[model samples]
Target: MRLLILGTGGMANQHAKHFAAIDGVTLVGGVDVDPKRVEAFNTAHNIPNAFPSLDAALAWGEFDAIANVTPDAIHHPTSMAAIAAGKHVFCEKPLATDYAKAMEMTEAAEKAGVVNMVNLTYRNVAQLQRARQIVQSGEIGKVKHVEASYLQSWLVSKAWGDWRTESQWLWRLSKKHGSNGTLGDIGIHILDFAVYGAGSDIDHVFCRLKTFDKAPGNKIGEYDLDANDSFAMTLELENGALGVVHATRWATGHFNELRLRVYGEKGGVEVQHRHDWSKLLVCSGEDAETGTWKEVAVEPVETNYQRFAKAVAQGKTMEPSFRHAANIQKVLDTAVVTEQDRHEHTV
Candidate 1:
């Protein structure tokens, strides 16, 4: 598979490195609006071709697939172009800025008969994969309740650098800069993490989003710090399970962490992923009666990168598909609507 790194941002490096390491795949080209960034990306990754725009890259048209590491707003247009050119797509999360565009991309990719995938990076966690397996196998019976969260402290800590001064992070806190904030950012992640592990799609959602004041007048230069910094949602799965999903940038002390707890009639399952390590725990049979939770062994799962490459090679689409992502985006969009309309929204 000949792949194009569609954006030359920070995350693009991971895409390039992972795809290049695949035995049958090659990084044939790269695309970006910034000349210096794209050139630096190509030089760092040894990509043979670079283009100033997606149009130029498509005209060159040597690659078989695109690793769309573009910003949240750019995914729709670039992905549509790739699909029109009959190229497979491996897109980053949120699929698009909203559900409508994401659905359009999903439908176009499907109609084009091209393999499509979204990089819901949490899917790569072995514990998440095993938790899904356990739920599907009825080991946890029918999941009745779930609790999930994605927590980060970047706002309070300088771990990844100061968002107050850095345009990269500042734009994320501003709506005009094309950022959906924490809910739009990591919300996709924990939503995918929870719903995927529960083995069900969200049926309805109601949410409350909060924006905290940062700096005086909440103004950091040209960027208005109005985007949500924290959010909480009440959701119902298609299987009639009730759950709460939340994410926040104000979660101090923790750098980054995702945890999911699922409870059912017969048993319970829990998965925790912090930084690099993950673990899956289960309580069932007599252990449930005794109130004991034991760790279950789980093997590593194929990453979204590897899966996208394999799908391209095999002419098939896999989990975390474009459709699934669009559905996830529906939930995310619905949450935003609930905040706007002051009521629960359906997914």
Candidate 2:
């Protein structure tokens, strides 16, 4: 799998590292809006080529697939371009900031017969995979309710400037950049994992979004800090399961934490990110006194990149396909609308 990576940010570097590590994959080049960043990415990753734009890369780079690690707003355009050129795409999540645009990309990829996958990173966790298997095996009986959250303290005043200043995060907090703030950023992952674990799609949502910390004194240069810093939503799953999701960048103590708890008629499961990738707990049986939650050891599995490479080499459809991402997009879209409607009703 020869690949062109379409971003020069942190995630792009991770992609390059993993792709380079894969036995049958090659990181051909990278593209970025900034030539300097592109140069740095190429140099850092030992990639042979770097281009200032996708057009330039398409014209000169040798690759059969694109790693669309670009920002949320650019995901749609970059992916559509790659699909049009008959290249498979491994895109960062939310598919697109806009649901319709996401649908278009998925439809286009399907018509082009190109492999499409989203980076729902948590699904690659071995414990989460085990949770899915346990749930599907009916050991948990019927899934009844779920609670999921992704928390971060990165936006706290002390941590905000550790990497980049508050000004740098403004783009993520601005609508012009096509970020869904904390909701579309981390919330989508919870939604994807919740659905993956339950083997169901979300059918309805009632959402609320909050911007606790805004850029001081009305503006941070030209960009306004209007995007959500936190979001909470209630969901109804197609399989008749109820769930609540919360995501925040304002949590004071959390560095990066994602936790999910699913309860069923007979048992319950919990997958949490603590010291390790996943800490899983499960309890089964009808008697409360006899059933006690016990830690379940998670076995190792292939990394997401390895699975992607295998799918490419064998010409198999990747899990969490573009269509699956489209479903997530629908959930996000519904959350936005539900929040708006809730606000209007209150007003």
Candidate 3:
């Protein structure tokens, strides 16, 4: 398979590495508005073609798939163009910033009969997969409650201002780019994992969002700063499962700390991120009468990207489809809507 990557950001570089290492795949080229980024990626990866714009890359027309790691705002348009050009797409999450655009892209892919995948990489984590297996095996019984949080200390310190001090990364703080900051960026991963492991759908949500520390002088280009630095929500799921999700960039001492705890009728499961490894801890009620907790063994599994590639090659469907991704997007949309409504009422 020939793959063309759009965007030379960190995520795009990661994708390039994965695709390059995998057999039966070739990294055709990459495109980025930043000439330096494009040149750097081409030089580092030994890619023969480096296009200044996505249009130029698209013009190549020799790729079987397009890996879109562009900003949240360009996800829809870029994916649509790739799908229109008869190429499969692997788009980075939250799919799209808005539900309508996401749905449109999904519909387009479906109508065109092309394979569309979203890079919700957390779903590929070994511990999370083990949790899913335990839940599926009735080891956890009926899932009742879940709590998930993805926290970072990036914006907690003034040093993070370096990225925002430039106009390059400023689009992240803009609402026009879609779904406001870290909520869409990292929160969606936890939300998707929660829904996936619990095997339930969210019905309604109550949310609270805030911008605790605003660095006014930190401007990234022409983008305006109208995004939240932190967002928290309580979700009510379809199966009477209650969930709490928190995502924040302003949390101190927590760098990429993602964790999830699920409680069920018969047992509970916990997954924590520690440095480069994820640890899974499972507990079950001892007996009907005693009602005591006991540790259960959970064997580790590898990541999920290889599974996606396998599924694509074998012509099979992955469990969390773009359809499933769309569900998460709806919950995210509703949470934002609810937060805004409450804010309006308070005003």
Winning candidate number (lDDT): 1
Per-prediction TM-score to the true structure, in the order listed: 0.98, 0.93, 0.88
Q: What would the TM-score be for candidate 1 when compared with the true structure?
A: 0.98
Winner by TM-score between candidate 3 and candidate 2: 2
Candidate 1 residue lDDT tens string, 180-220: 89989999999999999999999989999999999899998
Q: Report how far off residue 1 is in candidate 2 (Å).
A: 1.5
Q: Which stretches of candidate 3 lie over 4 Å from their true place?
A: 158-170, 176-179, 216-224, 285-304, 317-319, 343-347
Task: Select the stronger candidate by TM-score from 1 and 3.
Answer: 1
Residue 4 in model 2: shift from native, Å?
A: 1.2
1-347: candidate 3 lDDT, tens digit per residue: 77888999878778888888877878889899999989999889888888887778778787787788998889989999988987878888878878898899989987887777788888767778778788778877887889988888766665445545655446667776454777777778878878776767787788888765465553445665677888888887787888898988777888678888888898888888745777777777565346554444555543445555665677554655667777778777777778877732110
The CA lDDT at 100 in model 3 is 90
Which residue pairs come into collision in candidate 1? none
- Each prediction's RMSD to truth: 0.9, 2.7, 3.5
Q: After aligning candidate 3 to the native by TM-score, how far in Å is the CA of 257 from where it should be?
A: 0.6
Ranking by lDDT: 1, 2, 3
Q: Higher lDDT: candidate 2 or 3? A: 2
Ten-residue region with minimum lDDT total, candidate 2:
159-168
Give candidate 2 regions above 4 Å deviation.
160-164, 213-215, 275-277, 286-288, 343-347
